[model samples]
Target: MAGNSDPLTPRAKLAVTAGKAVAAASRAAGRGSGSVIGGRVALKLDPDLLARLAQNLDVVLVSATNGKTTTTRLIAEALRAAGPVVSNALGANMPAGITSALAGSSEARYGVIEVDEKYLAGVARDTDPKCIALLNLSRDQLDRAAETRMLAENWREGLAGSKAVIVANADDPLVVWAASSSPNVIWVAAGQMWKDDAWSCPSCGGVMQRPGDDWFCGECGFRRPTPSWALSGDHVLDPHGSAWPIHLQLPGRANKANAASSAAVAAVFGVPPQVALERMYQVQAVAGRYDVVQFEGRDLRLLLAKNPAGWLETFSLIDPPPTPVILSVNARGADGTDTSWLWDVDYTRLTGHPICVIGDRKLDLAVRLEVANQQFQVCENLDQAVQLCPPGRIEVIANYTAFQDLRRRVGN
Candidate 1:
């Protein structure tokens, strides 16, 4: 909560200048937006660059296993109702990228940052945010972060005694445990369709019993707290018992849950829930997610699902039957070199679609589909997959790098 007038030290000022210069040079070289490399240089010059850059701005840090980018974008858009907001809109959620983003926009009154799940605690500590949104935590990147419970514990410890208002999901046990340490919290009953990671209680290591919509640890007293905000179908039911209809350009119940979390955070900054929601409806897509592009007289809708939990959500948004579906995956660094997570996803849901597989890990995906008794065509790339389909709309579901590759090729 440092004010905007708080001047940066001489070293910090120099670091910011040098970082911006490197970013510009990187852009000229077409090495992608220089956010990460430039941020590294800045942090190297001044180790405290992120904290210094966050001074005087009302920061809102958003973290989740899924929907981090989309939720961050929604939060930023809702905050625009108050004043100018700056964000790392292109999925750069690490400390260095965050430093570069804040350093680049000094005039903005607010900062909305999407944080990688594993790095959320560090980012939260440095930013000292006005509000923090914990959407959900599930199994993601087994190679990198295998312990989801450890992540929840880190969140609980990192946010202990923080003054920020916590906007968290009441439906997810991992999120509930993580945000429970905070003194102030606004709980939202955002639906959790994938509950594989939260069966064991994080606090007591006991089995959680879900008799109905309520979940409680039988051994320990830890349970789902009564939600102040709840989602019923397409509406967001607030604490005041007023149900507001959520009409978002982004499809699925997942995006609606994200909007509910965003509206709750915006309320802490004096923006009304209705006003915040009104602003959020304008966000049709986050980066390339849900972006529809035309290629070779066919429409392709791009969806990014990096893990099993994410895949479950994306499956609900895809077009029903007869619609050709393209499944792509990669074992790249960004996509978590392990493709074993594919088995956890229910490929049986894609029963009627003419499914085509592509990417470096297409063979793995094909084998999984085959195990499910689902027929699929293995293709070399997206263009070949699209060629297999008739002239019409094609649904594309890909992991991190595969989605990015399709987006670039399709000019999205």
Candidate 2:
């Protein structure tokens, strides 16, 4: 049981109460937690309570800078296909949110969760999951996460005491090297040519060379065997548009990588790879994470842009560009108070293109676009921006809070 004096417990209780209150209010108002405000409150409070509840179940925790939500959802879906699975389907990766999710579920054989990197150590201490999936780590939320090296070190220490089977990303030097000492590790690799970042070894500060489709160190010679599961060749047939035949509703290489990771983890739990892949094709994009909606005769595509890698990958998927994009930015405390990470995004890719900027931080986004030598029309508000977007097809890149605001405004 959590110590009473632990500050987290009281805060957890308050959060849980607030969540229930909000749910009640939404119901009374004839709405649902899918509402903008309801979703925000739910995301904030659920994790803490979920962490507390996770103590009762056999948990599988998944954590990474990218792909955590998609992988978690995929694993949960596959596990359900096999049997019963309890999971936080809304991308609640923190301990409390996970606990809340578990609390809402009935007794189940598996508790599969997507955990946040910052809170993984604490959650692991409380729940002691049966399996831990450590996906790739990259530079994200620099203001909060510090550095990749620091996060890797923290994860190593946190996972040191865990007895759970470790599932790692073999191509990511950070994940592979960090989990090298763990005896029960399952490594998954996604083709050699697909390696985008993390050029050097995280251990011994050595140069990492690609031995095959996987990575290895020339100095330390810490090489990983080929992944028990791998995704080869060109899985992404459509790089420029969202209408890909892969059957995944989300676009880009990142989604494909996420699908591959989820399949691998599911395979380890007695779910066949073919069955997992079949279910993966049925995977729908989570709300606000590349979900396309019909709005007033216009197709509005919403892609979440919380970090640089995510933003870059999203842009890569929309090649040739949407005629006029409604780019919204918000630096609300809940959506990450710091906005410096915006500089890290490759806005230069939009050079010579025109877009419509909207939201509380519209001027800031316009400034960014101007700095990148791109053209954009700044809208005073989201409604005007939505109204101005061409009718046939439109794209929207929004931060967390701005996404909800836009969704509500567009009636999605």
Candidate 3:
């Protein structure tokens, strides 16, 4: 239970009251997740609910095609040193989730919220966050988001009028363009692993040059901006080239980049980069991501891989050589309902690892793995799939829905 000290008007209070009742009922009935419907009801009652609720609050907005949820959690954890930070803790980035978060803890003066890629500008306008962290952009849920550049273009328009200081990833070409015109910006050289969505310049359609870690366009002047903070090997280097060790519980180079970005944002509030990183290390999991749940009498480390880029980064975290992993792929609506992106990813990395595939889209994944010449066996059911693995610390990677289903199954 959180403190209650809302400054809302009588009408807004009534709307929120009704919304909470609906959310409680939804949770009791188990009809939906309750995050969206509660927000929907609140918005239906008061369309300007978020704008009104955001008054006098210090808010931070985190948006990206991937890692937004975990990044939001890290930033929120860091912000807690200052005071209580309200956020959508269930990995909900939509308006409803933000509403539920704000309405749930109206007393908190600080908020660390995750905004979906498409709705960043609008949410920023309404909530008017004190800082907006722009993480990397790649092809994710393209059926709903369209071209990856369109999101960057929207950010350009949406962030033009933003008064908040911008903390953006300079390593990503698309993010560089998105934060180009913004007046106040803190650039971080967080790595971009996926280059499929960045073949051409978003500005002039010119071929992008990847000389080394950064990128530049031949026709357009667009290029990776000089970063204020950058990841050097296993360390995060400041402008003075001083190295700070990134010892986070979240594994992989991508999480190091996320912690670096979070530290950059925390620095704006006078939190030392070292202090911020220390707090981030306390975070072992974001939602169900990176959780080691006991399932079917074996410890399963859960990895959420929603798209090609997500799979690439998540897979890199697994220990090298003979790593046994459970690969589940589901083409649910939340996962963009298209399994075609499976081909875009180079699954040959799993050649040495023992692979067991499951889920509704297991056949599609099996076909992909077979063509990639990876040795793997298919299991018809997840329960039976767990029995196939050795009884020990087995690693499990799944797409959006499959991951959530497993999380619920394991009671995480």
Per-candidate TM equals: 0.98, 0.81, 0.96
Put the candidates in TM-score order, highest first: 1, 3, 2
lDDT of 3: 0.86
Candidate 3's C-alpha runs over 4 A off are 1-7
lDDT of 1: 0.91
Error of 2 at 181 (Å): 3.3
Q: How do the residues 143-168 of candidate 3 rate in per-residue lDDT, one tens digit apiece?
A: 66678888899999999957898999
lDDT of each: 0.91, 0.69, 0.86
The root-mean-square deviation over C-alpha atoms between each candidate and the true structure, in angstroms, is 1.0, 6.4, 2.4
Worst 10 residues of 1 by lDDT: 1-10
Instruction: Kindly list the per-residue Cα lDDT of model 1 for residues 235-316, writing each as its tens digit.
Output: 8888898988888999998999998888788889999888888889899888889988999889999999999999999999
Q: Write the per-residue lDDT of candidate 2 for residues 1-412, one digit (tens) a residue.
A: 1233333466665765566576568768866442334334644764445445555566788998777887888778777777778887777565445655665555566788888888887777777777788887777655567688778888887888568778787777778766765677877664322244567667777877875455677897777665665554334221122222234666777777777677667766777666776677667777557678887777878878777766777777764654567788887765676777777777877664458898778877778787887878898886676677767667788887898888787777
Top candidate when judged by lDDT against the true structure: 1
